[model samples]
Target: MSNMLLTVEQAAEELKVHPKTVLRYIREGRLQATRIGKAYRIDRAKLDAFAGVASGRTRPPHGVRATVIVEIPALTTEAAERMATFLGAAALGGDAETRPLHFNTAFDPTSGDLKIVLVAAPSDAARLLELIELQLGLSR
Candidate 1:
């Protein structure tokens, strides 16, 4: 069952449900999936398991995993404090709808030098960087 992979829409169609519902199931750990970029690829076998079936599936094609680094240059003391606060809220804001990417941040209290690392597929790196830039008001 691992060989066959289905997108969220395809899986939702197979189960006769909305795509958001399918995403919800994934979030609640009811359905199994491997996140690809901003999307998810569900294994056919896991789908069967989810449906209480016993079919073994095969692996699907996967994209190259990559990392993106966002180097936030040293900031003024006040701006650094603000950035820290923003990061705290950003983490809290992520929930079921967030991407399956991994994130790590290194912050310097005295120097105000910050570095953010995001792990995702190669294709998603740009979008993730855009999001981070927007959050930091760099777009303006």
Candidate 2:
């Protein structure tokens, strides 16, 4: 019985809610708990069920959305700058009013790999890729 029971404070911590909220749930019959003397004891299973419901652990409303992380190899400072400008332009075309997309550029002289990471919406991902291909002469 002790193992299956949790105190109000413990349940509140597990649920990430205030102790008062737990008490309110108990009073409102939202949570199934027992009054032991002056303390409230909640069943572990019931607490878990309530947590799943309150946290909306159900399936996503719609289908899953995909995010693409495009990486471009930049060999020189000029190439890196060009990649940055291309990504900036794509982000502007996609959503200029909103926050700009994130762009990361790193040059490894030893490896001779200039890396650029562009994080943007799926719709804008193709434009960015096309720009990189055009810059690198990879596309005919």
Candidate 3:
């Protein structure tokens, strides 16, 4: 993570607001900052979040990300639990420097429907897809 710190004045300039406004945001918890000996230091990423802009910190340069939603028409509870465990383990085993993977699952017991949402790098997504296919005995 970049330790880039911006002073209140710098943050205000980037935000196109007054310095006091930035301070007010800090007070209101709208913006996150660190107080160092009476001076507030704001993170560029935090500022970007407050401004409703995408931070460069999220996506690495030249990197490809994938968002995949997989739906299983029918799955047993035990099978779904096993799949979830396997996917979660894979997500947790990703490289430390790489962007973290987001995995979510929803299941309907009555309908035997299982839905999985995965946000990860392209390679990781492919790996997870392969695992899912293998678990489901589906070729492709």
Give the whole-model CA lDDT for all candidates, comma-separated: 0.67, 0.64, 0.78
lDDT of 1: 0.67
Best by lDDT: 3
* Full candidate order by TM-score, most accurate first: 3, 1, 2
C-alpha RMSD values across all candidates: 12.4, 17.2, 10.1
Candidate 1 regions with alpha-carbon error over 4 angstroms:
1-59, 76-99
Rate residue 25 of model 1 by lDDT: 75
User: Model 1, 19-123: lDDT tens per residue?
Assistant: 999998787555778999999998886665565443433323563668877778777767765654554444333333233445567777677788877676565
- As for lDDT, the candidate ahead, 1 or 3, is 3
Task: Kindly list the per-residue Cα lDDT of model 3 for residues 18-134, writing each as its tens digit.
Answer: 999999877755567899999999877666655645545455577677999999988899988878777766665543355666778998999889999998778889888998898
> Alpha-carbon error at 45 in model 3, in Å?
20
Best by TM-score: 3
Clashes of 1: 9
**What's the alpha carbon RMSD for model 3?**
10.1
- Which residue pairs show collisions in model 2? 74-114
| Residue-by-residue lDDT tens digits, candidate 2, 26-132 | 77555778999999998776675555432233544662333555455436666666665655445434311232344566767656576666665444556667777
Question: Each model's TM-score?
Answer: 0.43, 0.42, 0.55
